[model samples]
Target: MTQPIPPQKIIVHQLGRDYKSATRIVDDILQDPKPGQIRLRNHFAGVNGLFDAMAMQGAIGYIPLTPPFDLGVEAVGLIDAVGEGVKMSVGDAVATTGLGGAYRHYQIIEAAKAYKIPTATPDYLAIVPTGISALVALEQVAMLQAGETVVITAAAGGLGHIWVQLAVNMGCRVIGIAGSDAKCEFVTSLGAERCINYKTNSVADVLGEHYKDAIDVAVDTVGGSIFDALIDNIAPLGRLVVSGYASEIVEGAKPVLAPRIYERLYWKGASVRGFMNALLSEHHRDAATRLFDMMHAGDLHISLDPTVFKGLQALPDAAHHMMSGQNIGKTVLDLRDGV
Candidate 1:
C-alpha cells in the first residue's frame, strides 16, 4: 500500500517587520487527528494582513509569538478524516477561524473550532469573521437604525464592503471613504450614496462641510485623519465603531497634538467604541448564521480580489499585497496546489 504524502504549511520562524524576514514555508507531516479533533484538507486560507503584521513583529502583547509558530487565521476546507468521538465525517465541508493553521494544505484542528458548512469555498472566508465583525459592530455595538447616515472607511476593501451593503440593506444612507477614484466608484457601486477619495479630497473638509452633525454611525477601519473627520462631524447621539486602524497598523500611532476626545463627544451624547472580533466570540455563531443566510438568499455579495496567489510559496507576496493596502476585496491564498 502506498503511504500518504506529508502536507506543507507556513510559519513565522523569527520576528521581523516584513513577511520574507519573518516567515518560513516548511513541509508538515500530515498527522491523524487526535480525539475530539478533525483533519481538514484546506481549500483556501484567508490572508489577514494586519494580524500577520502583528504576529510577524510581536507588536501585540496578548498574541505572544515564539520562534516557528503557525502563521494563518481563517480557512475553508473539506473534512477528510475525523478523530475518535468526533461528529464531523469525511467529505463534510467546513470553515474554521481563530488563529493559526490556516496557511496550509491540511489542518488538524479541534472539532469545536470547525463549523460545518454546505460547501468549502473562499466565500466563507470573506463572511465568517470578516462579515461577522461588520454585523456585530453595526447591530450589537453601534445600535444602527434604518435611515441613519452611516460612514464606512476603506469602503472598497473586504470588511468595509460588507458593512456598506449591510447598512444599505438596513435602509441607511452610506458615505464611503476610499483612497482613489476607482475605489470610490467601487464603493458607490456597492450601494454607498457617495464615496470620498481621501487622497484627492480632505476627508475632514468633506464631512465637516456636507455631513457635519448628520452621521448617525461611522464604522472606521482607516484611522488617522479619517477618524478625526468622523469624530469631528458626528451627529448628536451618534455612534462610531472603531473596527480597525489600518492606517496606523504599520507605522504605529503617530504623535499628534489634538483636542481632547471628550471635547467633541461630550455635548452631542456621541460615543466611540472599539471592536475586537476575537474578544467578542460569544456573538460569533449568531452573526455567522445571519451572514450565511444572507449570502445563501442572494442578499450578500462576496468579493474576492482578482489577484491570485496560489500555493504555500505565494504567501509572502500575498501577505505583502494585502498589508500594503492594495487588495480590492478579501485576499485569500488558494491551497489546492498539488493537493
Candidate 2:
C-alpha cells in the first residue's frame, strides 16, 4: 500500500510589525479530521491585505496572535478526506472562512464550518468572506437604500468592487474612491456613477465641491484624511461604516486633534459605525447566501486581480501587492503549485 504524502502550509513563525515580512512558508502536515470533521485540499485562498497585516503584527485586539499561527482566513478547496459522521463526501468542493484554517495545502476542520459549493473556484474564494463582508457592511450595517448616494473607499479593491455593484444594483448612486485613475475607471465600469482618484485628487475637495451634503452612506476601509473628508461632507442623517482601516493597519490609529466626532455628527444626526465581521455573526449566512446567488445570477461580478500568486510560497508577495494599494481587484492565491 502507498503512503499518503504530507501537506505544506504557511505559518507566522514570528511576529513582525509588517505582514509581508512576518510570514514563513513552513512545512505542515495536518492530522486526519476527527469525527464530524473534513480534511480539505485548498485550491484558492483570498489575500486579505489589512487583516493579514494586522494579524501578523498581533494588532487585532480581540484575537490573540502567538507565533506559529496559521495565517489565512478564506479559501476554496475540495474535501480530501472525511471523518466518521461527516455529511460531506470526499471530492466535494467547499469554501471556508475562519481564523487558522486557510493558507494551507490542506485543512482539517469541522464539516459544518466548510460551506459546500459547486466547485473550488477562485470565484468562491473571492466571495465567501470578502463578498460577505461587503454585503453585510452595506445592507445590514449601513442600511443601504435605493436612490441614496453611496461612497466607497478603496473602491477598486475586492470588497469595494462588490460594494459598488451592490449599491448600484440597489438603485443607489455610487461614488468610488480609489488610488489611481485606472482603478477609478475600473470602478466606474462596474456601474459607479463616479470615482475619485485619491492619489491625484483631494477626496475632501471633490466631495466638498460636487457631493457635499449628499452622501447618504459611506463605506470606508482606508482611514485617515479620507475618513476625515467623508466625515466633513456627510449628508444629514448619513451613515458611515468603517469596516477596516487599511491605512492604519500597520501604523496604529493616529490621534487627531480635531473637533470631536460628535461635533460633526450631532448637527447632522449622522453616525460613524465600526464593523468587524466576527462581531456580526447573525448576518453571515444570509449575506453569504444572497451574495452567492447574486454572483451566480449575474447581478454581481468578481474581478480577480490579474497578478497570479500561486502556492504558499507566493503569499507574502500577494500580501504586498494588495497592501501596496496597486492591485485593481481581488488578489487571489492559487494553491495548486505552478497553477
Candidate 3:
C-alpha cells in the first residue's frame, strides 16, 4: 500500500451535553468530500459566547445538520490549496466568520465567505471580529448618542470591555458594572469613569448615589439577575441593549418575563432592544474593518489579557475557562503554533 501525506486538521465530530464538555480534533476531514471549495490552513480562532451556546444546545436544527458535527464560527487563516475555478492563492491570510467549523488546522471554506485581512495587520490584532460584533451591536442596533450616561454590565469582559471603550469614546459617561473589584478596576483602566462592583454594592444604590438620576443607556452583557436589576435604573426614554446572558450559564436559572419588562419600558417610555453580532454578508467585514481602523489609529485599545491556548486540544479547556469567567479578556485558540 502507498502512503499518503498527512494533512493537519482539527475536527469536531460531536457536540457535548454540558458547558464543560469538549470537542475532538482529528487528522483528516471526517465529512464526505463536498465539491467546489478550497482547503484553508488555519492560523487563529476567535472564541466567544455564541460558539459556547451553540455547542451546548446541540445543533438547534437551523444549519440542516444533526449531532457529531464540526462547531466553530469564525477564524483567521490562509488558503492552502484550491479546488476547481477557485482563484485565491495558497498564501492569502483571510478572516472567516459564521458558518461554524473554523477552529481547525485545515478546512474547506467557500471563496465568497472569506475576507482578506490586510498584510499590515498582526495576527493578534486581526483576530478581533468578536470585539467588532460588540461594537456593531452597540452602535448599529442600540444607536447610542453622544454625552449619554451608559451602564455596561460585565464591563471587564471581552465584549463588555469593548462596549465601555466605545461608549466612552462616543462621549458617554460609562458606569462599568463588573463581578469583582479587580474586574471593575480593569474596566476603569480602559477609560471607564466609574466602575461598579455588583457583587459588593447594590446596583440601585450605586446608580442612584453616583449617577443621581436614571442613565440614558444600559448595555447588559450578563443577563439574568443583573439584567433585572438594571430595569430600575433606566431613565425615561432610556435605551437598554441585551447582548449576552453569561449569568444564566451557571446552575439554577430562570426565564425572565417579557410582559413585565415591556410594562417597565412603557412606564418609563424606554426601549429594550436585543442584539446579537450575527450580521450577514458585507456587514461583518465592514464592522471588522472599521474597528481595525480605530485600532490602527490608536483610538481604540482592546485588552488581550486572557490565556492563549496552543493547539486544538486546549480548545476545550479554554472554552470551559471562558464559560466560568476564569478568562480575563478575549479567549482565543492559536491554531498555527501546532497541529
Candidate 4:
C-alpha cells in the first residue's frame, strides 16, 4: 500500500486595518475533505491591489466580512485529496477563486466551485478572477462592437492588459492609458492604437486633439480624475464601464461635482455603468471557458509581474507592491515551496 501524504497548511492572517498591521503567517493543518469537497495543494495565488488594500481596511463595500479573514481570492493548485462523490482524480490541476480561500498552502473546496486548469502555467493565475472581469466587462457589460474605439485605463495592469488584447482581437481601435512612459510603451506593444501617459499627458487633451467624439466604449479601472476625463471625451451613446476605482481605493475617493458631470454627459447620451464581478456571478463559467479557449489559441496574452512573492509571509509585501503602482502585471504569491 502507498504511504498517505502528510497534511500541511500555512495561512496569512489578517488582524486589523492595513495589510502591514493586519497580516501574519500562521501554521495550520489541512482538514479531511467532506463529501463533495477536494483538498488542494496550492501552487500560486494571484493578488489584487485594490481588493487587498480595501479588504485590509475593511472598506470593500460589496463584501460584508470584517477583519480576521483570509487575505486572498484566487489560486491555482493540484488536487491532493478527493472526498466522496467527487469526480476528479488526485493530482488534477485546478483553480479556486472566491472570498477567503486562496492564501494558504492547502485548501478544501467544493469540487463544483473549482475549475480544472487545462495547463498549470502562471498565466492562469490572472485568468481566474482578473481576466474574467476584463473579458466579461468588455464583452457583456460594455457590449463592445467591432471597429469601435475603446479606451482602457491602467492599460498595463493585470485586468487592463487582458482588456487591451481582447479589445484588439474584437476588431476595435484601442486607446490605453498608463501611468508612465514605459507603461505606455508596454500598452502600445499590446496593439493599442495610442497610449497616453497620464503622468505627463492630459487624457482629455490627447483625446480632444486626435480622438474627439470617437470613443465608443470606455473601461475605467482607475476612477477620480481619469473617470471624469473619459466621460468628458466620450462619444454620443457610448458606454463607460466602471470596474474599479484604484485611485479612490488607495488614496480616497473624491466626489465629482454634479455640474461637471452633467455638463459633459447630458447632451452626449453617454452612460456610466458600475460593474462588479460578484454581481454577474452567473456568467463566470462561460466567460472563463471562452477566455481559456482564447488563451489556448494564442488569441490572448497573460502577463505576470516579474517580482515573485514566495510563501505566505511575503503576501503582505506583495499586496503593498501592487498598491504602490510598480508592478506591471498580475501580482502573484508562490505557495508550492512550503511556507
How big is the positional error of residue 237 in model 1, measured in Å on the Cα after superposition?
A: 1.1
Off by over 4 Å in 1: 1-5
- Best candidate, lDDT-wise? 1
lDDT of 2 by residue, 1-339 (tens): 545445787788788866556777766766888999999988889988678877888777788888878889988999989999998999999999988778888888899877788988888877888888888888778988899999999999998999999899999999999999999999999999999999999999999999998899999999999999999999999999988788875788888887788988999999999888788878888888888899889999999999989768787789889888879889999887632
lDDT of 1 by residue, 98-202 (tens): 667798888999998787889998999998779988898898889999999999998988898899999999999999998889888888998999999999999
* Model 4 score (lDDT): 0.83
Displacement of residue 209 (Cα, Å) in model 1 is 1.6
lDDT of 1: 0.88
Q: List model 4 lDDT by residue over 229-333, tens digit each.
A: 788789998988998888886668776557756667778888888888888888899999999999989998888989979877787688788777788878888
Error of 1 at 262 (Å): 1.3
lDDT of 2 at 262: 93
RMSD to the true structure for each prediction, in A, is 2.2, 2.4, 4.0, 3.1
Better of 1 and 3 by TM-score: 1
Q: How many residue pairs clash in each candidate?
A: 0, 0, 1, 1
User: Relative to the unseen true structure, what is the C-alpha lDDT of residue 88 in candidate 1, on a scale of 0 to 100?
Assistant: 81
Order the candidates by TM-score, highest first — what do you get?
1, 2, 4, 3
